[model samples]
Target: MEETITPTRIFSRWRWLYRLILIGTVVLSSVIPVYAQSEPLRIHPALLTLAEESPNEIIRVIVQQNAQERISGGTLSRAGAQVTRELPIINGVVLELPARKVIDLARARGVRWITVDAPVIPAATPGSSCNMLTNPGFENGMTQWDDWENTLDKQISGHAHTGAFAVRLGQPSGAFSQSLQSATAGGTYTASGMFQRQSSNVRMSVGIDFFDSNWNEIDEVYTEIPPSDNYVPVSIAGVAPAGTVHMSIWVWKDPGGSLYLDDLRLHSSSMDSGACAGYPATAGYNVLANGDFEAGTTDWWLNNSSLQVTSTAYNGTKAIHLGQAAGSIAQSAGIALPGTLYTARGTFHRPIGAPWSGMGIDFFDVNWNEISDVYVTIPETSSYAPVTVSGIAPPGTVHMSVWIHKNSGSELYIDDVSLVGDEVPDAFVQSTGTNQLWHDAQPRTGQGITVAVVDSGIADHPDLNIAGSNNSRVLVSEDLTNSADKLKDAYGHGTHVAGIIGGNGSASNGIHRGIAPGVNLINMRISDGKGMTYASDLITGLQWLYEHQAQYNIRVVNISLNSTVPESYHTSPIAAAVELLWFKGMTVVVSAGNNGNGNGAVPLFSPANDPFVITVGATDDRGTGSLDDDVVATFSAYGTTIEGFAKPDLVAPGRNIVSLSAGNNATVTKEHPSHKVGSQYFRMSGTSMSAPVVSGVVALLLQDEPNLTPDQVKYR
Candidate 1:
């Protein structure tokens, strides 16, 4: 006898399954951490293992102590520990010591827990060296430096070399000074600053003053500056004297003249050892070390006990679990200079009721003082979602850190965090022979052509936001999904497709330029924010493009999507809609779908099955410039249509192609956080990426020969 199921019965069955899975997970979680967190012993098992196996090996560790117990340099030196970094945020010091001394160091008076010191990634590597002075630009109103004569006033309005403020000296012979506590005794330090003179006859002097253990000045070296009316930059190099524990940067003027100082800087002359190491050197745009958490909490700062690296992940083998009320996992690095742009991106998931969580950046001055912070929150979602925060570094920004933080809420899982500068890789463009074509005798760049992207909306990005003398590259931005008239790339697909077709590579400093970068783009958002669309939505977008083709010079129509079910091209409505546009002289490009089984028998779907339009398949170029190793992607569609017509007129490079990534909670970026190249671009595969390559070529052809019909252009 057949049985019928009601809603209550279905819920009851699902409830049992959910309970069983939850119980299994609970049991597994309790069993997994017993070895890693053998806590009652007051030391990590890894450290204990290192101490036993390699007693004399030098290892790095973070030493935490009781609140009342101060850990001075003398105390660490007594234990044979050399301090590497002082982290006052968590009241700890990062040190390197022989493994045998760690147990003795931990048993010291008022000792707290100690963990292995993992290396963190810097926001950027400026030239080669890193700045080490705080408030060097006087943007903080003279907060970190001391004025010897107390005759200085901060200039707030204008005449500053960089930011909004500068320090003005009233007394000519007076000086300003700041102590460099992190300086090395025998290392060479360089000092540079900007000087704007009120009178050209005055002389400016800047140098480094070395000091010994008793706060006594040992020796000094100075660099004299010639007079200049406009602000001029001058630098001085000095080697710290022997027995110098620290040094101070000094700036002074002579001959009784008013001089303004701004943009002061002090740094080591040579690059620090292993300063740019620790991160995955091959990951193109990832600047955070161990961001995937696959190596546990190696480079992350954990202040509380509730944070852990767990097995639950969005796109990798491991992810971070934040259980504390106000806990975060962060890694800090030294920045290039003020006004440099940075972006922080990551993914988060909540298993229970949603609460607030964020990905952010904490900006620091030259002395590692917290100057300011900015963040972007993830939406309420049970599944993983991407979040991005981007902005220019404020004045006096010398160091910064990217963090995934959460307030009180259900437990949150984070994965694939990255903090990177504004640049992207160009391997995909070079592999497709587009870069070589760009340098041809009479280079064609789709100057007068327009391409329409029919998928998710196109987001605003520096690469696609190009403008000419009068008009912007974006001709029209309309939504057929009925959500809004204007467009935003909530799903990130259309923006990537648009970038592949005509991005100018402004965000990447022209390294990742598109195939036809000068072409105009028409964003016809046919899908909803989550990339859910129907045949009706596609038809609506196609009809609108047909009507406005002449007005916008829309020579190419790119459909990087397919129908759910297969149908004959003669009967499918989407196929008819695309055929009408093709008959009207618009070149239509469609993705051949990603359901191939490598048997050459998979049924093709419409409008990909339509013979009138150009259907493109995808090839895996393996991120190289040569096609010698190219292969057809296993998932790329291959087959004959229902009516026995062979489809996919051409193929193009598509696997792991990097293109523009939408910023505001983009769906694909969240779904596959590992595919992100940097904050500005994402890597994706399938014929959806392949179709745009052909569409971009169509735009180039139309620009070179504007009189060609759709059929003639396709023939070329």
Candidate 2:
């Protein structure tokens, strides 16, 4: 006999599954180390199978200790015979010791694991011997530049004498100097560069500062620069004093507006020097080392527990796969000078979004204090797209960090990250036409209409609240994960999805306002934070929504989550349940899933693939408001379902979308700093974020004409 299992029966099965997970957590917590909690032990598996075949006499390794125990100096006392050198402790002291001792160190007290610290061999620097000044071209940003006085602004720009970048000094007063460590006493040197006057009232000059054997400044000379937008070639000759021991070159501008400098060269007066090709003439080199990930995880440091090398690369043979947004595969870019403009580039992909995920480069000052950080979102894609973050590094900046971070629980793959001097942001979405379409509609903002969110639970965000009251517009929340837990969001997806529907943007000063800000919300949560959910739980949530639809004025239902079972509307219970809700006087909208955007023939997710429901796909709005730039989101599932219907009723903006955050402990808030829209707003992606947008619009339509049937709503 054909049978049916009601929502109550599914609840009983869920209780058992929850109990098993709870029991497993209690059992594992005692065995795992604290660092493992942040990231797992990354011990190269070959270490346990060590043999004499290993080359190299000495190898570098990082030893991590347990949380409570400190790694004392005597921890590796047995390895004294094999120890060659000791570097400063970062994760731990980088030790150059025999590879044979690795197994022995693994058994040492408090040692969690030993990781091979392979050194990154950078691309050779040409013209090293010919150039007397360290960082003469401003290639390493400010690696060798002196900025202790801190009177003026120093930054990197794309305008160069011959290359793609140059250093610019702005405002009041300050100086940038490169020290020539080695110079024969009494020797003559010539300093030449591309210079430009950019609004500074006072003249900018280049000169040399001579120091005697005792480190006292004994002599100084200067050369003046004329005002110009284009680069003006200038040079100055200086002779080391009789008692001079060392010298430093300086490019200075007095209090005024700005002076730009680039392609600087300091050489013995006898040899002639000129600007190299314009693209990279200043540094004439890429400062970011090993950016292609060709050497495995050699130069990249793991933030989460996993090694990053993957087969999904944009250019090279390998890439980095990331899980947690908390930690990232990070590497230091060449030194970045304060106030210099920098451009970052990379490619990222995630089939199932959390695309609030992004890669970023952070600028740090000479004192190692953070000056500024910039990030660019990685849209959900089966392939990849370019991401860029370009801005002027804040004052006192001397270095930068390039890392990849995104929404936690969302898997991300990154490849070919490089930070150069300058910026051109690839637009994430459009801003025009969207406002006009909604504002010009009848009934305005879905005022009295209510939407039922039958997926994840929404959080109590300040902007999502019903104006003055402490309660949120998200009403009647129920956590299907556990009866013991409150109807609140612990895993982060639902809050962001709901925020996109009716968030008021109170916290973000209206910068991230939702589609239907006036619509009421009823959160019926079924999924966990990472968005993992079962079909039974979803069916139950839908059934419960049916029972309580009258208690709340739920005119629209949004299901951004999906199931893989591709049964027809005639055979699928979930499809029948949603259709019943539609007939009961509510419009249902669902996500087409991420599988659609790939090149292969993608099948629609169940229920969404059903002909009746409004299955929404995603579109890349190109960070603009006009429809001219819009294209279907690469990850939104499309094509015909097994039910023989071409689905995805429509497309909506889903790339780099910003909305309200779910407070401090929320997943997206903690893991994806790159997606932070403001103190209270966040950015995310996917058809999951797209579906609610349609639901909100449906709410507005329903408000305009209250008695519209499901067929009428679909037709509209």
Candidate 3:
């Protein structure tokens, strides 16, 4: 190596070693850090710029901490930062400090980022344009509400969405309600409010109750709000039932974490001006829970030990015994409506010379002051003699009580005591599963929801009239069939269908009520006498519904007819028309034709065979509310459709179902005179009757969940 060291070799080796040293120096330079003393290492870029512009300015900011790192309050206080809020939910803290201190604070160990604390504006009070609720914001301190006495401690400050106060529920046992007397039957109303919950387990519901003129509860509806840490808004709208003269809006909470509510609002589209057609059937229901004295003396106010329940039968096994003279037993029935008729009747029996006994009604004002009293003295007899007293509820009558009294020393037995209002519900409504809905805490009567009946026509019936107003619930009657009787049901089929959907049971004294008695109907008359119509007529009816769906708020369309021939749904014009409506967001319910003779034949129909629409079959509930004896009606079409789709989509009670009859002279009524129920109702057996039961159910579903689409309804 030493011998080869010439002048050229020494120059090449030294040049290569110098190149390697220069490359190493360059790499070392890239690894070294450049320094700027004033630059912020962890501060947000926007905050850094702001600090530069306004070093001494005070501002609010939210500082986020790194994982496993917490900004101690002592450190923040020492750095001239005023802590505003500790947000454990986001692992952050809101602070107010000088802009110059923000950079210093960000330079601390384990600091993440800091940004300006922007102001958050809450949403405007829902339904503010026409908020019917007084003191809706809770800023007025619980005034104008019906249950303020119970909610006095519930109202609190500092937790509102916008105002200074909100309703904070301490327990989930009761409700906060406000009675709205301006709501009219058939009028539409919207209710909304803002709510917040401290934990995800809390649940709440905003509800409305419709009451008739007699103060009888007709229907009730409820909407649930989603759980959220912060304030969220919820809204629901419904139509006042046919007999609704007033209503109440309320909010109820379920057990869990804390719940807060504010800005409750209610808006009505129209004023109540005698819109109710008649009192609801519930009006005539017995208000006294223990009128029969079967449950000991639970509801009765026993004035003394002289009164007791005995095995003296007037109607029921147990009756009330006034064993001592001047003894009295009373029960508070309910609130009374002015100008409404109330009947107090009871059966009384006494020994030959027993003290004179009487049963009567007592009316009281809001203060519980006795306003007036009416009594009927029972004739002295060994056997029980019936005594009755009836009168119109007087003005200023807020409460009613039924009392039984004895004048002198002797034993008197009383039984079958009843206080019935003018209207009563039909017993058959229970057979269709509607009784379950009626008895629900939040009953739904298809209020504010519209259903289209594209059959013959809806005739003029009292049950079809809107309660409290002089208007027909048949919002519109379109004659697509060009029949001689315009807007009238000459075939008696459409009337039956309409009645099944929304007849209020006003006739027959509420003994023949329909399923969804509160639903508004739009009659699209496509069939003439004898239930005859062409496919084009049905298409025209569907087109009309499609065009006016928004105007009428039509949500469900019921077609209880079928074509004369079976055809593929893909090519059938009627099927295409129904599908178009279904896609347009209308729940189309068609009846499986009455062609099945228990042979399990494929249905011969078009719209019913359409895969998109809801096809309904028929079942016989055996004239009972229990479904144990239910069987498919022999004529209810079943099996697969021509398009290879399984049908019908569902089954409902249809055999011998009693519904509205057009008249004695109507075609079906005249042909089937034996099936006529009185002069106002008809009993028919077919899938034509089954479809409307499902149609009424659809109306109820839409009333509860208005946002559901046709597909969603079908799935539900």
Candidate 4:
């Protein structure tokens, strides 16, 4: 320094020294300060552990007060506990620390803290959990707030946390200010949590607040919360205006002190969208079944060509085990175009664990080869499930075969098969206007005539197109047994009777037309497959027909089926009812029992034998009528009534007489084997097949004289 250096060099060196000093100061200030406090006393981890482990114990303090008085007057206590420094004070005793004392203690302990502004309440005991303190009268500090108490007595004590707390509350009158936070506006919100109250009578309220972008309170809502486990839904419409929204829930204590809440969560709106639509139309027709085979046996016609309708035994069975394989020709036979749509259906039920079983319908052409098959698999439930088949061959001379094959075990069943199509017109009487048989009189048009048909039921056949004036042709039909569900012909008998009485005037190949084509029919179904009908149901049906005769314009009643003659013919309820209807100017035409021999000795069945009923006997195509019938049908029972009336007031073509079935070209089986084909004109023999002929004749007569009484109509 003593040596005189150059001025330029000295100035450069001084500038360098100044920059170094400035950098050193900046570095020192950023990294570490000279006067910063170090190593302040914090609550010890051991003490915190002790406090948590034994919450009921009070904490004590021993402070080393420095000359700077930094640790002077230091105290230790639980945060929310009340505290007092006195000679009588005891250590490890739980007490509430006042707000001032808590702040003072925290400051002395070198910790920044805020005390709960409200009066401090002691927390629940160690190993205890409960809502210990409810709203305890912030309105009035003077009033006692511990009157109502929730005391949870320990029911089971084993684990550390098995204890519960006692909560107390004081009733107050004024509205309490509740500040809430963090709720969104214009959203669907559901607040649900489990809450248990010590007592029943308690009220709760949930408060919410909405804020704007400026942090200003925009709106507020208050709702009452019922004490239950079900979700309480609350909705907020419109926007919250983008600020901190607030929400708070409060319980208004009744006599009960506390309520508990657990598992609380909030959910946002879901963004899902979808729905349901509708159904489709059904598919085409099928052949359900044909009756030519035995079910559950090797006797299927396909396996055995020599199957005949004879008494035989197979598979350890005596009689024919046709089972569901027995086809009902009456129910299934029909006419079809070359290619048409149809469905055949039947039902079968078997016990649990039974072997697999199925039903099928076979269609045969004129040569009787299997052209098509409709089959169904049986389910092993105790209920009937419908089996179906569709798609059939065109109209021709065809026969159906129903088959049931069981792998093992027996089954119970009911068989129903039908050719589905638009209904063809049924055979009906054409108007020949003459009141006399075989006359060339002009048939009248549009004259109202009613024929009552009591049988299985009538199909809406095309041949019987006589609709009532109101378009309601079926009038006063009642099922006495409540068994016949609809006017469906389970047996072919009803259709035959209907065709004979009032068939529509449509015929195929000069066949299937009935006698009285113009008359309307009132269908009454009174029997099931057993060929039995209850007397009460029959009486009710007759009474209904009688009562509504005027409305229906019913002029004649055709009873094609007969039961065994009651012992007393005159006092029989059916006879009485028949007489009453006859007296009411309605003619009753009955079938003379087919039991009579050429000798006139056997009396016909009752109702038929009744004086008021017109008893009709049978005839053949030869026009040679029998004394009752030419040769009595073997199955037809002989009549032996005390009434000395020789049966069969007259005869009609019953033997091999062709008639209408329920549907077009329906097959009818009778005593004659010649009637088995699908020919529309079937050769049938029964008083059943005969009575309808007389009914049609009556309709023709009524067409000429509308007001004829029962007696006059019969006499004519």
Which candidate number maximizes lDDT?
A: 3
| Global lDDT of model 2 | 0.62
Query: Rank order by lDDT, top first?
Result: 3, 1, 2, 4
Model 1's TM-score against the true structure:
0.42
Give the per-residue lDDT of model 3 (tens digit) for 1-716: 52532223332333333223211111111111212334334443445544554466676666655545667665686568887665432335667887767766765544444554431110010122235666786654566865534642364433555433466776544577899775666667888888886666666779888998877889988898777878898888888877688898987766556677887878665321111100000113456776767567888887756777887767545788887658688889766765667888888887787767777888888899988988888778979888899877789977888888887687888887888765322323665678578558888889899999988788899889886565889998888666666548787778888898898878777678788888999988877775666554566678788779899999999888776434455434466567667766789988887556464574456677888899888776545454544678655678886446899988887665777888986777676576667878876666777788888988888888999999999998
lDDT of 4 by residue, 61-145 (tens): 2221111223212244334444331211000112244222322343343221121111100010000011111122121121223
- Comparing 2 and 4 on lDDT, the stronger one: 2
Q: What is the C-alpha lDDT of each candidate?
A: 0.68, 0.62, 0.68, 0.43
- Residue runs of model 3 more than 4 Å from their true location after superposition: 1-428
Q: Give the TM-score of candidate 3.
A: 0.41
Better of 1 and 2 by TM-score: 2
lDDT of 4 at 69: 28
Of 1 and 4, which scores higher on lDDT? Answer: 1
Model 1, span 486-513: residue lDDT tens: 4487777888888999888887878767
Per-residue lDDT over 1-716 for candidate 2, one digit per residue giving the tens place of the 0 to 100 score: 83454433433333333223211111113211233333332243333322122322455454533434545556465554233333211113445555555544544555544544321110011122235554565534556787749776665543444322357687868778877655555568878777888764687888888887666898888898888878788889888776777888888888887887876778774332111100001121234667877567787777776445787778645777776554667788645655556777887776655647777778887776777788877777766777787778787777788877765676777777777663112122123233344557353677788898876578778877776767777667777777334538765667777777888767766666777777888888776654455544565677677778788888899887765333344434456567667767778998877544244556664667778899987776544344553667555668877546777888876655666666666655666555555567655666776788888778777877888977899888
The 10 consecutive residues of candidate 2 with the worst lDDT sum are: 273-282
TM per candidate: 0.42, 0.43, 0.41, 0.36
